[model samples]
Target: MPVERSRRLESYNLADYDRLPQCTNRRRLAAGIATIGPAIAEPIGRRANDRLPFPPSTPVGNIVLKLHQESSGALNTITSYGDGYVAINLERHEGSIIVMPEGAVIEWPVSSFEALAPEHFEALVAAAPEVVIFGSGSRLRFPHPRLTAQLAKHRIGVETMDFGAACRTYNILMSEGRRVAAALLIEA
Candidate 1:
């Protein structure tokens, strides 16, 4: 039989070390103290004065960060698809449909590529998307240029792919915050 070795860690009380000076570099300490002026002033809602002197050794660069927050479930995204149906935001639709990045899904009247007409693309134009993704059922196919002339008139671009590829592309475009619409034809 093998003997087991105890692996318990020895703990030290942190209260004993609280009185010790945290930072050893005097110049760094002075720079940190200098920067704290703006931090303390901001909470009181006062604009910080730019006249404060910084340590000459510290290098400063003009860098700005712009942040935009979006809720996870807010956008209407194509989540999954198959031969007979496409799912948007986890809800499955069996017929042809048009989906935009951040709005309700629109039911496209055409069920197959043969049924597409100039007016069939009008829904996409009304949505004013920057790009349109055309998914032609189970295989890749291109629609006649005249059918998409309305989109071209508005300078909106159109991309055609198979049903599966279109669903994948729509999700990618939606995540990028692009004005994209997917016209999917489910033929099964």
Candidate 2:
């Protein structure tokens, strides 16, 4: 019995799991990644953000660009995100702004995450989209949840994400004919 146990132990290393490379299931891993590959590229839905390298960006000058869908004639889509600016509907905009398909581009005066005031969220009530995508700059920084109380009263939903992610998510939601609004903070 001791000898059989010894042989079994020799077949598997004590640190087998710890010694794993970036990918463990070599053959199956490739197939699995391929399965969710498209989702990893541009994840959709409210809870589909499983991948980290989302809305891949290319750097230009001080901007990091991630272009989403194209506009269907008058329908708006986020064309790209550049460093401290974003291009929507082939037009480049600097600073923060609120975007909606077939709606006027409303410029927001927010500068950075720390500058986010409750009134900032309060102001979005007028836009009145079913859902609001809050792009908290280049990285994901959640605002104080309480700030959205007013919007919540009107039964609006808010999803916060990075600038690039928000751009992609906005297009994804818009394409599905959902009432979506994107409030992007592009300065920092």
Alpha-carbon lDDT, every model: 0.78, 0.78
Lowest-scoring 10 consecutive residues by lDDT in candidate 1? 58-67
115-160 per-residue lDDT for model 2 (tens digits): 8888988888987899999999888988887887888899999999
Name the runs in model 2 displaced over 4 angstroms: 1-71
lDDT digits (tens) for residues 1-188 of candidate 1 = 99999977554455743344542444544565577666656643334434234433344332122236665578897777776988888999999999987778888888678988999987688789899999987878999999999999999999999888898998888888898999998864
Error of 2 at 132 (Å): 0.4
Displacement of residue 158 (Cα, Å) in model 1 is: 0.4
Query: What lDDT does candidate 1 reach at residue 73?
Result: 75
Report clash pairs, candidate 1.
none
Give me candidate 1's TM-score against the actual structure: 0.62
